[model samples]
Target: MSATFNFTFDDIPNLERKVAIVTGGNSGLGEVIARELARKGCKVYIASRSHSRAEAAIARIREDIGTDENLAFLELDLETMKGAVMAAKFFMKLETRLDILVANAGLGGIKSELTPEGYERNFGVKHLGHFAFVSTLLPLIQQTADGNVDSDVRIVIMSSKSYENSHPIDFDNVRTTYHSWFAFLTLREMLQRYSRSKLANLYFMRELADLVKDRKNIYVNACHPGLVYTHIFDLSTSPLPWYMQLVGQLEAKLLGINVNDGVKTALFLAADRRVVDKNIKGILMYPGPTDGFVYFSNIYIRTINKLGLDDEARKQLWRFSEAALEKA
Candidate 1:
């Protein structure tokens, strides 16, 4: 492990009257982050596809945080563009202000599969789904910011360091035709797709920061929650190649941080007063050498410049996403 980040849940201030949404808040890092935010007195809506899972998560969070005043569930299945729009509409119905939007839900290594909407599952959920959701909710986010000039409204996109492995997105070949390949090679291909999805997150964040730069009070940023041992792989339901599984098991045991520790950077981006005071936006936040430190010094600058921070690509992605939503 690198030096522990100094930022922790204790650093979060009272969030009374604040309203936030955490996508995929039913499990893993999202769950931990949602629970902590509620503990700080924020009204949190845990958005997920599974009603039962969301309800169970809400119950667990309430029991853990000793409150049910702020926790609720919103149905959001990123598998389709309709789901994303519906999720945003649901939020609008319940609240007038959206203080924070954590686009934290995502998927990883799986067989090449396409959603009913004709997009790759990983790219659709991790990037396009969030792209549509944010676009739909931008007005509300901006309105909230306008009313509260004293503080910042946050949009936190969860990205990953694995994005370093991605090549520029091949708009034409996004939905690859599955064919027979060596098992290990198939794993490699799937991981590359995953990387591409994460790369989309970074690109979207950078471009969004630029698009909304004049807004001032709406802070748009991305974060890499350090490698954590979570059920993200869904190993029981979607087993990996034996050797790959062995390698993953070894890595998890040796290097992965616990979920609680993994969520600090996101929490920092969402609630750290320093981030708001400094007007930090469109940057990627991660942990630093000390336990309470949150690094916004561009550690991923090289990779981001190489693969993520392209002006034309960002515009194309936005256009493509809009078209996708239109078709859906």
Candidate 2:
């Protein structure tokens, strides 16, 4: 992996008239990303399921930036296609253009519980929900791009390095807890399913870029924050072997990079000029020690092998997603 220039929050440029939406922006890395975008003079909508939490985050951001004009909350629930669609429509009614859409909401370290929509929780929110959200919003995104040749419309999907650990995604297993028994048997099952969802995120980015390839102003990307500590780890730690559980408990409480560092790659994908300069679209970006990304050889290697998606897999994912959205 070739190491390039490092990045920090200061690297994000001014966004005086830009508009951005970050899902799960009420807390964790999402909150940080939303806050930074707001600070840089962008109109930011923190799309979240909890209005109260989003309000609190907004207040904190206001305190940090000494301004509230750029921050607002949009209701969003990523567990169902209906909610995702409704949220996108709502945003569209509120704003004519969208500069950035960060599909950053996700489930982490969860057991084999299904969503209210009867899909696996990880896959439902992380993949299917964002799929619906982006699909509904694509027209507006494309419109913004078409409205200006210089417009840099960005769609950032948050995948994970754990994608390398995923089992081959079995479409049959996504709609229910077909792995519930196995999930109860070992921690690997939980991680496997979660990683499977991240892989699904990658596949979504893969196909979306292809869908918009001719649209020079639009960029679609998926990325992982590397090993960053987030509270979701507590949920699945109990299922681990006792020794690994001990380590996981400690790590969950005190491990990984700081939340500030974790947000860099996403921010880079969102606001960095290098992305547009290099045409960095449809790639899985992972963090390096300090900043920017580690340039891996398989950046576009979406073959069915270990790390990314095959064309058939990407097609199947899109087809299933389109069918599911229609069903919803």
Candidate 3:
């Protein structure tokens, strides 16, 4: 695909007054995004599951960015819907407005399991947790938009290009039937579940953008961070086929982009003035490595269409998410 717009952290304007939250900010792409925002003078709250990890990330980010005042940690565990709700409440209690909300935390490549909320582990944490968190904080995001005339209030969901592989979500089978099996079969199931959750992220982003379209000042978008080397895969923790492990190592060594490069599209959607100027919303962004341009292409459009994603599907997912949260 051709590059459409060239963007980088250099294009991010001063964010001294902005307040942002990045889920899973303790490591990987989330940490990269948080550090960049902190560097740009934004107050960044690193929300994740572990207190120690989040604290360490905050400390490291503060040291790296040379400012400690705006970096803080808020405990969040997305495996449970209640944890997401509590995180939202905690943020609302502490911050008056939210300038950026990045749903960047996710997990993949694991054995089949169900969360306490009775959803597939991958779908529960990566999609539903963020869904609940965003639903609770959306009012504050809208309020931020209402008060800020000079900047756009943004929500960025970190989806993956693997979303292209997802089948249309089968709500009834979201908690997939489990069977103990060999490493390769388990790995395949894990990836399939992860793909489904990423697809859910896209559906949620599209529906959310539509829901908030009338606000005029709030912008919502999702992005696919091209393959990058990170610790999300732990072969020691979850066994993988020997050949699959070899392939993963080769891909990481040769083809994977650095985490810094992986985060460009998310940073663009969060802080780029063009997003607000062009009123870009509900679109999926893909950042090209060659020119650092973020664009929407026909292939992505065709993929979404082939996946059978429509307004009705989006709305159904929303309802299912809300009902699931209530039950949880």
Candidate 4:
């Protein structure tokens, strides 16, 4: 309902030769973003952790829009730096450039454990993994930006509204001293930790935008997809109470939008020209409710400014994140 943004897709022109990589593109919001890109003539790499899911996604996409020489898949596990580097190297050989990088693959807080790399599961996959992915792939993204001359290389991080409840990335505490930190927390504490991770996602986006501001034809941003029906709940610890699950089901049935719709905000910011001005060089967007007859709305002004994405905080977080990535 904010007057700052318009809800229309007509602003995006054909994306024919453009190449994009969408992590977690096999399911949920990522799937919808990849499909839309393919539909619009983008060569999309549906990078996923599961080969089976990737295969099925490719099959479905092929059926819906025909085999696009533009669509392909790559195995990427964001849980480790090696996987991120390998995927980046593989892509560098596969294509001459990368026009868009959607860091959408993420895991909600798992009360149980760590990834194969021994980092906290949510923090590892959600931030550190994606952090390494971008660092390794920056050359390609930079090249694409330089080559295009007219369009910026878009990097959209998939963040969440749950960020409000979380704390900033504790650079000091990333590597904990205690192995059993998981067992000591109550349910509410676990939720707070999860929220803290989500906050990191937002901070990462904000910091990235500032870091890349001087570069021409390169825009970095983050967004919240609102509430969508995804398998995130399936990963909850010890199976949520039946009533809670039932509530989620009811929300999906009545309140939740399809992943495709959920992803439209990212798509808009990633490709839309109206909001692509220099002012949007580092935007934090929120996808608002769609009114009848319109597929999307931009809720950035009403939502983000109040969230303390001020210049000072953004710069501090950027420095912190840069340090974290450098050490990793």
Candidate 5:
């Protein structure tokens, strides 16, 4: 059974008391996702690196929703586990339960640099840091349901089409020695690193799905949002020429989809109950024929199979993730 579905923004019924936390919710696809959740009456917590930007996003959500929908911001810096831990702690104190977690915060490619804690910027912010965030908030996620009857705790990981191009993360050199100072070279390396981390996202989701399968209430899925015009490009390691930017602008004007539209997969994976079981674990989703929608296709299944990612890779990533958290 394929895990694909469609729904319009105006159609989501009242969510009234449900609460959600969307990392990177201050801008781009993340902001659009948060707004959509709010439209459904979900109380959304926007987590991002900048307070001012998050505040502005909340204001925009208020304007778009045209109601006193519960929307707020939490400062979360994905470059460091400190920030992730702090955000989780703060959220736990404020909310008794969390219905959804959108691990959407990510970096594209940056010049090879280490964070203050000495992790590569791309993998540090995009994967391991968010990993820490999820770990910190796992308890709240489990608490969303009293005894796992009808209660649902869903996590929608915002992945990218680039997952096709990455390899399993090599712990031997978490900070990839593959460094390049040139803009294009750095971009290539970043793309590879980013793709690898996104693949990790899929594996992690699969592992978590099995870990919580007995709970029968929490749904974990990963998806690619298609070609979205967002800060993702701004974070690109490549020094894009003016012509490229012009082409991008023209694409947005002509064929590029709305950021909100790009986030439809996140919304579908988060709220849809049709295929909430572990049977749909690790399936990558994409936008469908309509606005604010999703559908699963076989274009990437063979690639996943080819990667020998069955049990060995999953176990390895789980072990690596635990050790990384312990080190942090």
Candidate 6:
């Protein structure tokens, strides 16, 4: 195995009496995060679109941790704005507080389609869907901080290193559909959909941090897990022929980290005392080499403007997202 990350599961502080929601936690890196948090005695809700899969994940978590307690499923379908809002509303009714939100559910691949609400699938699910979920849940998170003196409410947004490759947000084209032939011809646009969505994650995190600057103990941040060999990569290769898929998987096996190591930075931001102690917020971070654990950087798959969007662009995104949420 490659040199392990400096941070490990052992470093995560005890999360007893805490509550967490790991979106897309039914599998892959999110599942590992859910299990690790549950291991530390935190009540975790594995939020996803698939109830049966969520239940299975909960069952496996219970079996391995040897406890029926501290694990359950919260159905959250990020494919649509309505699903996102409803899930947040359901959680609001079910629980009084939300301590940690790992906005970890994200997807991208060869397909290009629009959600019912008319957004590109990647942009719809990764950015707009989470926008609705977090917007609906923001009050509860704020209340948790206001009410509990010891509460350090953390929102960990999952962005990708691919974000560096994205150009400015294309508001007009966001809802447009590119035919398969056209999309494949200008493949950059297809890839940009996912990358831009990730950049949106960072934009959301930054704006939230500024909004909560006055609020005590609320930490908002975004991170990338490095390139992990997960189902997402498999999905990326789905449209390819079988032999091509095999070749892609083999390539990923060489280039990407495993799911276990992929989760380190996320867990650190979630439960590490140093986050609150050092007051790390609003910063874009990725796993570092050795010296200091968290570093600010991203991987660019294609050459583009290296800089992120300005504040005006982010404000525009927020306004556009809020308007979109209104439709649901």
Residue 16 in model 1: lDDT: 89
TM-score of model 5 (CA atoms): 0.87
The deviation in Å at residue 310 for candidate 3 is: 2.5
Estimate TM-scores for all models: 0.92, 0.90, 0.92, 0.85, 0.87, 0.89
| Candidate 1 local Cα displacement, residue 67, angstroms | 1.5
Candidate 2 weakest lDDT stretch, 10 residues: 294-303
Tens-place lDDT digits, model 1, residues 156-177: 9999878878888898667663
The predicted structure with the larger lDDT, 5 or 6, is 6
Tens digit of per-residue lDDT, candidate 6, span 195-256 = 88998888888788889999869999877787676777665533444565576567667766
State residue 156's C-alpha deviation in candidate 1, in Å. 0.2
Q: Worst 10-residue stretch by lDDT in candidate 4?
A: 177-186
lDDT for model 5, on a 0 to 1 scale? 0.73
lDDT of 2: 0.81
The per-residue C-alpha lDDT of model 3 at residue 60 equals: 86
**Lowest-scoring 10 consecutive residues by lDDT in candidate 3?**
293-302
Candidate 1 wrongly placed segments (more than 4 Å): 1-5, 177-179, 237-239, 289-303
Q: Rate the local accuracy (lDDT) of all candidates.
A: 0.80, 0.81, 0.81, 0.71, 0.73, 0.80
Q: lDDT tens digits, residues 1-328, model 2?
A: 2324367778888998999999999988899999999999999999999999999999999999999899999999998999999999999999999999899998665556778888988889899999999999999999999998788999999888778788778988887663433434556677778889988988899899999999887989877775666666555434455566557657645656667777877888899887888887887666654222322111221223444857888889899999999988
Tens digits of per-residue lDDT for model 5, 208-259: 7777777767778777776666776663344444555456446544565666
Residue 187's lDDT within candidate 6 is 55
Question: For each predicted model, how many residue pairs clash, with residues at least 3 apart or on different chains?
Answer: 6, 1, 0, 4, 0, 0
Q: Model 4, stretches more than 4 Å misplaced? A: 1-3, 8-11, 172-186, 235-243, 289-299, 302-328
Better of 2 and 5 by TM-score: 2
